[model samples]
Target: MDARTQWDAGRSEEWADVTPDAARRLLTAAVQAFAERGYHATTTRDIAGRAGMSPAALYIHYRTKEELLYRISGIGHRLALGIVSRARDGGGDPAGRLSAAVQDFVRWHAEHHTTARVVQYELGALGEEHHAEIVALRRETDAAVRSIVEDGVAAGEFDVPDVRGTTRAVLSLCIDVARWFREDGKHTPGEVGELYADLALRMVGYAHK
Candidate 1:
């Protein structure tokens, strides 16, 4: 069987028997283990232990470590894309939309640091076919950001000379925050969001009103 087909077959079982809260806890533990130990080093037993569940219990939810990692990484990208999509759909001036998008991205990364870290650092551990699926999702995210920037530039709200490069810079800046931001840091997540929104606006030449 092909890799994609094999993956689909493996994931075809219904997990409706698992409670939403239990699944969330499992995903949380998986994210922490994947971030701290990396995909290759993280074992299902480690995630199960951290989540206070037995390995068999975890297996009832997820078939393997790879499946857990795949789900986390895939969800991270989807969440980011959803934020941008919603911001665009809100119907505002270019600057307002851009500010909202940046804030949303920053806040999401701060709130889901473990998932962000795994998505950023451990994606390579996915099998090649699964990696391609995630790569496409990431590309869609990049495209969405670029489209926002391009729209702003065309609308005369932003003065960036290179929309693509600016999009990458903005994304990188927000994604890296998951690496260093601490709950007890000098600035709260809201403060970080505001700061990043300001910086992103300035990068695109949108002066604060």
Candidate 2:
């Protein structure tokens, strides 16, 4: 239901709200298909087959493969926005807030790397309108991180000379985790999250007490 729950729920279970169970299965299939084969390379039949449904059944739930991608992107980005925004709005020392933000953000990327890989890397496959909508959500994510950096600078908790650039770097670092993280990796998602959080603090020149 909440962003944290969705993040911890793996790829398919995050679609709990998607009606008809069949639709959810399609989404789950789409995520897997796209992540493995890429949105452009993946076919409607491929998605349908993975979901155990016929090709026509995919149209009953989603108009096109792009639409399915848009839905996945929208859901994933909204959850990501919630994570960063909550950390920004949470009342705490700027250092603490920034660390929390990066921790949770990185954890989500690692925990759901499969779906995340599709949601993040498949942006170029979306239609024009869908692309614009997802971009708008991304800008909000940028703003949320920037605000945290601004707060840190204001409170003398960090020494970031270029708040905007540093915000992008922080977000890029967290988001890129989805690109390389593996379930069988040396570190767990929580360990990766903690490492990234500490690295983010150092990036801002936060002096740990």
Candidate 3:
């Protein structure tokens, strides 16, 4: 399949760092299966089959289904956190940085909606320890956005009354794109990102012009 098809089908190169071709294949297959059937419903055998491997091969790569979920969650969440953190640290004024953060964050979710769906929605299926780790990463992501809002407020560039709530609301708006975005949708990922960025700026009471 073409790269686009692979990505839309959840076989994205987002996990290209995963070692060994077989392991990457399994990771890709696991993402596809989990995104489609959910972590609780998807089986190791199913993932193995999708990767064109025997079930035993799955064991060699990943100890259990939850391990696959943990791997996926860790990678995806870190990627998301990096996106927001870069915008937070990037050289820009508060409004500019906030807009960049929301725009890029939303674009990633829309473009990688399939992977994002599994990453954002399948956390509950992770083991307790794994869940905690993911939660910590999520908190960092929240902090990244909150820091931008705080900066905006401090700079008098935004009129947010509740920085924490507004930060979450912004994240929620961007993250939800994964649940609903489609390649064939009226808006391309970039368009959705631009639109959401504008809305986010408005939410902060910034007169982005």
Candidate 4:
């Protein structure tokens, strides 16, 4: 499916943890504002206005605008980690697991481009502690991919010489989808996922089946 379709299909699944209707609206608005104007440029009033709530209503749930960003980034990172974790935990040899991980990871980046863009690109706006927490979550995600590559290397299923660097490349490639993907683009999320799965497998020297 196209990124838009994919996003709509999976939106609730990714964001279901966020509670209360007002908080959800505020978060939704913050995502748009942050994606369009960057975190530093977006104000709580703008977010509240877009959410159809008064400015003071924003502080009822969040202490500051940074807190709003912290909540969004936290949820986004958790969702990313969950995606990789499920793909890793699902049964497969190294090659199979790697393909599934890459496909799912890439598809999430494409389908959730708006929030993903803020999560991947606009994190610098977060407080130091918040940013550090997100970084820790991201490290777990890296380990998920790296572990698959490591398993493949050990089993002689792949020929990657630099496991750590190769793993980083696989994730970096997937994360870049947020930067350039458009619904009007030639490929849909599923198609892009398939392509990335192949590329990720090739990266680890797993010959196409």
Per-prediction tally of clashes = 0, 0, 0, 0
Q: What local lDDT does model 2 show for residue 16?
A: 76
Cα lDDT tens digits for candidate 2, 1-209:
64445446665556877999999999989999999888889999999999999999899999999999999999999999999999999998898899889998998898889888998898998999999999999999999989998998998889998889989999999999999997767887788889999999999988776
- Expressed as tens digits, the lDDT of each residue in 1-209 for candidate 4 is 64566578786666676779888889989999999999989999999999999999989988899998899899999888988998889887989898999998888888888889999988888889998999999999999889889988888889998899999999999999999998788998889999999999998998558
Off by over 4 Å in 3: 1-11
Which candidate leads in TM-score?
Answer: 4
Whole-model lDDT per candidate = 0.80, 0.90, 0.90, 0.89
- lDDT, model 4: 0.89
Each model's Cα RMSD: 9.2, 3.0, 2.4, 1.4
lDDT of 3 by residue, 110-191 (tens): 8888889999998888899999999999999999999999999999889998889999999999999999988777887778
Give the Å error, residue 89, model 4. 1.2
Clashes by residue pair, model 1: none
Q: Check candidate 2 and list the clashing pairs.
A: none
lDDT at 102, model 3: 94
Question: What TM-score, to 2 decimals, does candidate 2 have?
Answer: 0.94
